[model samples]
Target chain A: MSPFLRATLTIAAKDLRSEFRTKEAFNASLSFSVVILVLFSFAFDPTSEQMQAISGGLLWLVFSFASALSLNRSFARELQNDCLDALVSAPIPVAAIFLGKALANYFLLILVEITALAVFALFYDTHFAAQLWPILLVIALGTWGMTVIGTTFSALTVNLRMREVMLPTLVYPMLVPALMAAMTLTTDLMNGIPLGGDNLLWLRVLTGFDFIYTLLAMVFIDIVVVG
Target chain B: MRDRIMYVLATLSAALLTWNLYKIFMILPDEKNQGAIYRIVYMHVPSIFTGFTGFFVALAASALYLITKDLKYDAFAAAVTEVSLAFASIVLATGMIWGRIIWGIWWAWDARLTTMLVCWLIYFGYVMLRRAIDEPTQRARLSAVVSVFGCVDIMIVYKSIEWWRTQHPAPVLSVRDGGGMGPGMESPIYWNWLAFMCLASILVMVRMRQESISREIDSLRRMAHAY
Candidate 1:
């Protein structure tokens, strides 16, 4: 492997190991998802058909909020012992560090999204077992888009006094396009519609968003992470 | 000498806008279908375009700031963003008024309108991000990253929202589409667009001057404290 890839992997592995030891972000995000799910159920109290109509929006809403929470923690960890400064001072390229942290966030958020999906299925009394692949595809692509922007902004606001407040303000608006695509795709998949025409357009949008934001974040992260 | 140029440009833009307003209210024949309601389009379309132009300038200045590490570009970015926010507000307010009259509602999730609001939100985030950071160079660097991201994200938003609007149909005014305006209406629209762009240019220069003066004072204060 190239040195950059190796450095990226090492940083990702380090985050994964540290997260496994404490599960702080994981635990916080999961519980936040549960709370959001419960609140949504109370707010809507939808009948089964109504649930079917709106569950896609509700599911993505929960994940977007939870992703913000976890991404904030992921970067906050770096600030704990001036570890970010130490990492920056090291020989690793800054892009590698960005990819590493974003990769770890991607994995963590995906796991939380899966858990949210299961809980949503149970609460809304809906089943997605048949449309599993398409649903997962939407979730993965959407989560990656969210993580890329979220991770970058989390680092951007890491040193701020109001960072926790700042992260979501920056991340949420940026993620709106991708989340809208994911929601629409989820709704269509639930309706058992094949991907064509409008559905394909949305899928293309989600893919394009993922590609552009990842590339932009990679290019911009060095500016943000370094002095 | 530069001040005289700005004064001349400002006076010219003012004269052009006054003339355009007269043409909109009196000279242009009202649309057969909507009558006077179509008049707001003169302000609405131009505001949106000028706001977009301001954002594009900020995006370019931000990129230059990052590349050159020059504070001048940062000042330019900040100035353009502040002016753009004013233009964006005008766009939203006029849009809401037009919607009320045309669509019989205060607001609807019309794709263009929704995307414009999101654009405003993203720039609002950009402004807040700068205020939250205190260090000069770091603030410049991070805000530049956001300005670039904002520029790219708006295009994605325009695409995604356009597709979403098609799938979920809503009552659109269709004023700009099939109901083609004659030269009488089109002339005022273009003229006002030019006026708004000129006004936007003058405001950006004024704001840029203010930003640099404030920055100079900050550095001078630091120098005095060192003595």
Candidate 2:
């Protein structure tokens, strides 16, 4: 395998193994997402129509927050053991490190999203008959975009003086476009809208955003880490 | 000595701003359709223009700092970022108020508003990034990168909002159409723009001087401690 792919996978496997051992980040993210879902359930009127009306937004909200929460902690572990310094000093490419962290974050986000969707379906009577695969694809692309940018910001902020508060402050605003696109797609899928027209337009927008931002992160990650 | 000069410039800028405000409210002709709320255009237009000016100044200063490795240029960039953030805040506030009067709603996710908000948030993150980092070189380099990224993100925000659906009308002041504003309105708007540019320049100059003085004081203190 190429150095980039090997480095990315190695770091990703390390994070996944470490997370599996402690389970702190994953558990916290999952629990927080559930709590957010419960709160949304209580806040909105319990009518099926109202529940369906907001399910997409609620899912994206939970996923966004939960992803931030997980990404913030992902670096904390590395920092605690001077692992980041070691990684920085190593011969591996910095973009691989960023990609590895992002992939780990993507995995965590997918888990949180799946759990949230399950809860949403149970409570809101949401049906996913034909558009399920397409919706999942959108979520995958959107989440990858969010995690790429989120991991970069989180890594930068984690080394700062006010790591806890500054990470989300830096991450949330930049995530708006991805969140908006994800919500739009999710809503379209839930509403059973045809995927070929305006929905495709939004999907294309989401894909375009993912492409641009991911490329940006790749180009800049080395500079950010080393600097 | 520099303080005195800054004070004099600030006073002159303030005076000019007051005169321009008077011209906008008392002397300018009312729009045929927009009526009195159109008066907000004076504040709104100037604030937006000044905000953009501040953003470009920040970008230029950041680039200069990176090239020169000069602390003075970093201070200049930070000053520009601060003033730009202030102008962006004013633009957002005035825009919202204007939207309330014109659109019958307090807030709308239109192209202009969304892009401006995103732009403001990016710089806000930039400022926070600087605050969180304690090392001078790291802070300067990181924030410079962030500022450049912010400029690119601003362009993306502007383009995405335009290409996608949004409530905001197309540009009212495009050069392609021989300028969109009528002759009567253009004169006062131009005057207001000049006034705001002066004001923004004065603010940034004052801020840069203050930061430089503070840095000098800090270095002196460090020397005393070492001795």
Give the poorly placed runs of model 1, Cα more than 4 Å off.
B157-162, B166-179
lDDT of 2 by residue, B1-227 (tens): 76786677778778877887787778877877788887777777778778887788889988888778787888888998899899889888888887888898888977567867888888998988887777888898888878876787676666775557877655566454676666667666667777777778778888877888888898999999999
Record all residue pairs in model 1 with backbone atoms less than 3 Å apart, i.e. clashing: none
Most accurate candidate by TM-score: 1
Please give the distance, in angstroms, between residue B216's alpha carbon in candidate 2 and its true position after superposition.
0.9
Residue B208's lDDT in candidate 2: 78
TM-score of each: 0.95, 0.92
lDDT of 2 by residue, A79-155 (tens): 86788899889888898888988887888789878877787678767876677898789789888878887787777
Off by over 4 Å in 2: B1-23, B174-180
TM-score of chain B of each: 0.90, 0.90
Measured against the true chain A, the candidates' chain A TM-scores are 0.97, 0.95
- Candidate 2 interface RMSD, angstroms, 1 decimal: 1.5
